[model samples]
Target: MSDEDSRPVHIRRRGLDPADELLAAGPLTRVATGSGADAGSQWMATTHAVVRQVMGDHRRFSTRRRWDRRDEVGGEGVFRPRELVGNLMDYDPPEHTRLRQKLTPGFTLRKMRRLQPRIEQIVAERLDAMARAGSPADLVEFVADEVPGAVLCELVGVPRDDRAMFMQLCHGHLDASRSQRRRAAAGEAFSRYLLAMIARERKDPGEGLIGAVVAEYGDEATDEELRGFCVQVMLAGDDNISGMIGLGVLALLRHPEQIAAFRGDERTAQRAVDELIRYLTVTYAPTPRIAMEDVTIGDQVIRKGESVLCSLPAANRDPALVPDPDRLDVTREPVPHVAFGHGVHHCLGAALARLELCTVYTALWQRFPTLRLAEPAQENRFRLTTPAYGLTSLPVAW
Candidate 1:
C-alpha cells in the first residue's frame, strides 16, 4: 500500500471504491509510464487538496500535451490532431476561455432545465422498454446504456434514427481494451459524424444544442469548435452518466439503507446523487496535466515538463476530503469533490449531469421499488478496461 507503487491508477478500483493503495498514497506519487502520453514517468496527485492545486493552476500544470517534453521535440508543436481542435481540455486559458465562453450559454442552468422534459421522457422510454424486456434484464442494456445516449442525441439534435450508430462510435472509442487503431478509427468516424451535423446546423438550425450554438455564434463559431463541442458532449455526457447509473445502482443495492435515503425527498435525492458521484468517481482522471514550469507541492517539486495525472477517485476518497472517506453516506452534507473536476476547465455539462442523475436514480426506483441485483455484487463484472469505471452488464430484477 505504499504511495510509490506504480500501478496504473485508472484500473485501481475494487468495485465502487478506490483501491486502498491509491487512497493511502501521499499527496503526490509516481505512476508508471505506459499509462500517460509522456515517455517518462508520470506523477499522480492523490490527495484532494493536491489534486485541486494541479487541476486549478493551469499556468503551472498545462492540459496541452505539447507543453510536455513528449511533444517538445517537434517544431512549434502546438498543432492539434484533428480530434483535439477546440477541445477545451487540450487548451490553456485564453483558448479554453474563448471556446468555453461560446459554449457556456448552452449549458447554463436555464438551458439544462429546458432540456429536462426531454431527458425525463427519454428515461421513461428506456424504463418502458425495460418493462417489456422483463425481469432479470441487464440494466445496462435496458436502461443505463440507452438513457444517456438518447438524452444526448436529443441535446445535440442527432436525428432520432441515428442515435444507435452514434452510441456505437462512443462505445468503441472509449473501450480501452480495443486496439489503438480500432479506437482511432472509431474516433475518426465519430468526428466525421459531428462534422456532418455541424454542416447541417449552418444552413437551417434546429432546437438542439448544436443548432443553438450555430445560430447564436453564426460564422463566429468555426465548424471545428462546433464539432469539438459535440465530441466533448457525447464523450462526456454519454459514458459518464451511463457508468454512474450502473455503478451507482450497484452501490445502492449493496447499501439498501442508502437507497431509502436516496428515494426520499427531492433535496435528499439530489444530495444522494452528488454523494454517489463523489463516491463512485467514475471518470478516473481528467486529461493528464503537464508542468510548464517548476512547481512545489508538499515536499515534491515537479520540474518543468513532467506529466501529472490527478486521481479523481483517489482524491475523493482521501480522508482529508471527508470523515470516513470510503463510506457512502448519501445523506452527508454535500462536500465539494472533484468528480466533475475543478478550476476553469471544470466540466461544462456538470449541471446537466446532476439533473440526469437525480432524475434517473429517483425515477427508476419509483418504477421498480423492489429492484435488486440478480446476483451477488462480488461476482458482477466491472468494466476495468474502459476510461470510466462501470459494469459491463448490470443484471437486476424487480
Candidate 2:
C-alpha cells in the first residue's frame, strides 16, 4: 500500500489528512469517524501547546470518559475494562493521588536500577535463543514482543511457566486485529486472574510490584482497585515496550550512523532510546479527555461533557517542539516530548522501560551487528485500531 493509503488508523479515525497544515490550521479542530459514537464531532488537540495544555489542566478536563474504550474508538476497542479502572490515568486528583503515592515506590529509579542486570540477562538470553533459531527470524516474535512479555511476567510476579498464557491474554487484549469479542474475553480473563491473585496477596502479599502494593496499601485499597491497577500496568508495559523495540530497531537500521552509535556503549544506547521514543511517540496517550465544565482551550470554549483528544504524534512532531521534527537523529540532545505524556499521569514505567529499551537496542546489535530487515517496512503488518501502535511482526535476518 502507498504511504498515503497506509496512514496510521488513529489519524484516519480522527478524520485528518496527513498533508494538511496540522499545526497552522489551529491547535484544536473537530473530526468525526464514520461511526455514530462520535456523530456530534470530537475535539482533537493537534499541536504541542494545546495538547500539553489540555493534559496539564485536569480540573477543567477529566479522564472519566476514558472508561468506555469501544465508545471512544467509535467502534474499535481493547480488552481493558472501564469498570475496573483504578489506574492513575483513569482517575483525577485525590483518588489518583492516593493510588500514585502507594504505587510510585515500586517504580522508582532505585528499583529500575536494581532490575537493570536482570533485564540485561533476559535480553542476552533472548538474543542467544534468536541466534539458535537461525536466519530470516521474526524479530517481533523472537525478541521485540517476547522480551517485554517475559519481563512483565517477572515484574508482576507471574510464574515462569505462565508467561505463555499471560502473553496470549495480553496479545488478545491489545492486538487490534483481534475481534472485539475475543479482546473483551481476554480482558475479562485477566481481571479474573487479578482478582484471585489479589485475594492471595491480601493473605500473603508475596513479592514484586503487585505484591508490594498489596502489602503497602493493605485494607486501604480494595481488591477491585488493586486488580485494576495491576491490569493497567501489565497491559501498558506489554504493548509499549514491544512497539518501541520493534519500531526502534527499524528506525536505527534506517539510520546506520545512529545504529552504530546505539551499539557503541550504554550512554549512546540511552540517547538512542530517548530519541526513538520521541520520534516514534508510540503511546499516543493523553488523548481523549472530557471537559468537566466550560473549559477554555486556546481561545475555544469546550462546553461541559465535550470529548477532547490530544494527538501526541502531532504534538511530538511539531516544529515548535524542536528543530527539524521529522528527522531521527539519535545523537541530538534530548528534548521534552509527550511520548510518556505530561503532568501527574506521566508513564509510571518510564524508568524500567528506558532500561529495557537501552539494554535490548545495544545488546541485540552487539550480538548481531549484521542484522537487517528481511522484509520491507511496509510489508510488515501494523497493529492498528489499538490503543498503542506497533508492528504485528518484524521479519529480520543477520
Candidate 3:
C-alpha cells in the first residue's frame, strides 16, 4: 500500500465536526479513500458552491457510470448483486427521471402532512417506551433506533409482525463493520422480503407506499423498480432519520435552548429541523459523482472518469454557506444546505425525514422536559463506520 493509503484519514467526522482534513480541503483536493470499489484518489469538493456545482450538473458529472456505455439501465452489464435495483441515485436521466416521477407522488409535502398524525403517534410511543424503560435508558435502543424503522415499516406497509425482521435485515445490510459477503447476504434477504411484499401488494394492494405504487402505476412500475423503491426508502428512511434523531437529541442536549426552540412554534420548529439537518449532516457524503468529462472546478481540472466526493458536513459547515457554521443555531434563517444533497439524485425521503424529525424533536422534549445524558458525552459511542453517522448507544435520563 502507498504511504497516503497507509496514513489514517477520517473522511467523515470527529464527533460532530468534519474531519480536520476534510474541512481544510479548500475548494477541491485530491484525497485517497483507503479501500473499497471507490478506493484510490478522487477529488473532494469541500466548499458549498463547488459541491453544488458537481451535484447540480448531472450531465457533466454522471451518477450512473464512469464511462459512456449503453448497458442495461439498472446494473445490467455491471457486476453487482441483482437485488440492487431501482435506486434512483444509481442511474442518470431518462431512467432516473422515469423512476423518480413514479415515486415522487408518494413523498409529496401533502402526503407527508397527511402522515403527520401517524408520525406523532410513533414519536409518542417511542418516548413512552423510553419513559417506561426509565432513567438511564439507552436512547439509541429505546427511541432513536426503533422509531425510524417502525415508521418506515408503517410507510412501506410491512406487517407489524414483520417490522422486527425488516429492521434486523436493514441493520445487517447497513452495518459497515460486517464483511462484504455478510452484508450482501443481508441485502439479498432484504430483497427477497421486498420482492415477496411487492408480489403480495400487486395481488391485493394495501394503504402503504408499495401498495399505492402498485395500484397507481400497475405494470408500468416493474417488480424490480418497486423493490428498488422499497430498498431506497428503507435505506433513506431508517439510518438518516435514526442518526439525526439520535445525534440531534445529543446536539440539543448540549444546547438546551435549541430543544426549547424546537418546541417553540411551527415556524421555529421548521427552522430548527432545517438547521439541525444542516449542522449534523449525518449522511456524511453523497454517493461519489464520476466526472463524465474533463471539468474545471475551482482551480483544479478533474479528468474524465475521475470520481468526486462532496463532503456534505464540510460544505454545510463552510463560512460561505452560513455564519458561524460550526455552532448549532436553530434560530438561523434556513440556508440551502446540501444535507439532503443537491440536484437530481437528492434524497427522495427528504420531506418524510423532515416531518419525522420535526415531530420527534418537538414531542420528545415535551414528553420528557428533564431529558439529559445519563453519562458523559465523551463516553457515548459514535457510529463512525456506518454510512450514516450516529450514536451507537446514547444513555439518557429524564
Candidate 4:
C-alpha cells in the first residue's frame, strides 16, 4: 500500500471533548494553529494518519524548531520564565550531549536503586495520608500529584516547606491561557528564590543533584541558567509523573483483573507501567518543531521553518506499530513507545519516572488490595487546558 494509504485509522473515542478539540486542530488534521480548542476544526478521524506519516519520516519532520519553540512558548523567552533547570531536553546536539553526559551519572541504575527506598517511603507516606483521609480520597491530590512533586523537590535540594510554592508556579506555568502572565510572575519569584538558593549552595553546597550541577557547571551556567535548570527538572519531571500515576491508577482500577494480575506477580507492575504510558500518552501534544530545510513527508512537502507537531498520544496509538493498538494489555510484549519521546529529545527522567510509577503501583496494590475508584470514573475531572494531560482529581476508596 502507499505510505498515505497505510496510515492508521484515527478513532474518535469518548472522554473529554476539549481534548478531542485540541487533537483535531493539531497537525494530525491539517487544521489552523493556536492554543485553545475553539480556534480549530471539528474532531476528525485522520489524526492517526497524520501521526503515522510524521513518525515514519523524522528527517522531513524535524523536531529542531519544536525544541526552540518550547523556549519561546512560556519557557525562558519574552514574557515567560527563563530556563533555569537545565539538564538536556531543550538543547541541540553537542550542547545536549554535554549536558546529558554530566546528568547521566546521577540517574544511573545504581542511583535509582538507592533512591528506591526514599521513593517507597514517599509513596507510603502519601498512601498513609490518603488512608487517614478515609474513603473517597482524591488520588490526584494525595498520591499522583503529591508524590512526584515532593520527590522532585528532594532531588533538586528544595526544602520540603517550599514545595507548595514550587507546585503553584509549575501549575500556573503549564496553563496555556495563563502561561504568559503566570510565567512572568512565577518566573520572577522563582528566579529570586533560586538565586538565593544557589548562593547558599555556593557557600555550602548540599549533596543533591542541584548541588552537583552547580559544582560542575557553575562557571558555564549563569544564575538564570541554574534557575532554568531547576524549573526544567521540576516541570518536566513532575508533570509526567503526576499524569502517569493518575492514569496508571485509573487503568488498574478500570481493569480489576489486571490489578489482580499485578498483585499476583511483581513483574506485572513494570509491564503495567509501560501499558499505562502507552495507553494514556500523557504528553498529549508532540513538542512542536520547525523544519530546518525543505523536506518531503509522504505526499506533502513542508517548507523550511514551517512548524510541525508530533502528537505522542496519536503516535502511541497508531495501529501500524502496535497490535490491538487500542486495547490496554499490560501483558503485551515490550514494544517501543514514544511516551517519553524518541530520538535525541528523549526524556532524561525516564528512569526516575519508571521508578516512581513502579513504586506507587506496587505499594498501593499491596497495601490496599481492595482499592478501587471511589467515584464513577466518568465523574473524575480530567485536565482540560494544559500542555500536559492529567486528571484534576482521582477519588479512590478501598
lDDT of each: 0.85, 0.76, 0.83, 0.67
Candidate 3 residue pairs that clash: none
Q: All candidates' TM-scores?
A: 0.93, 0.88, 0.92, 0.81
Clashing pairs in 1: none
User: Where is model 2 more than 4 Å wrong at Cα?
Assistant: 1-9, 12-25, 66-82
Ranking of models by lDDT: 1, 3, 2, 4
* Candidate 4: count of backbone clashes, pairs at least 3 residues apart or interchain: 13
Worst 10 residues of 2 by lDDT: 10-19
- Tens digits of per-residue lDDT, candidate 4, 173-257, equal 6656774877778767766787788888777777566677667666565565566677777777787788788877887788777
- Tens digits of per-residue lDDT, candidate 2, 79-197, equal 44555567667677777888788887677777677677878889999998898999989888889878988887777777777678877877788766778899899988988877877
Top candidate on lDDT is 1
Tens-digit lDDT string for candidate 1 (149-211) = 888888888997888898899878887778999999999899899888888888899888878
Q: What is the alpha-carbon lDDT of model 4 when measured against the actual structure?
A: 0.67
Candidate 1 regions off by >4 Å?
A: 1-7, 35-39, 67-77
Cα lDDT for residue 105, candidate 4: 51
- Candidate 4 stretches with Cα past 4 Å from truth are 1-13, 16-29, 35-89, 175-183
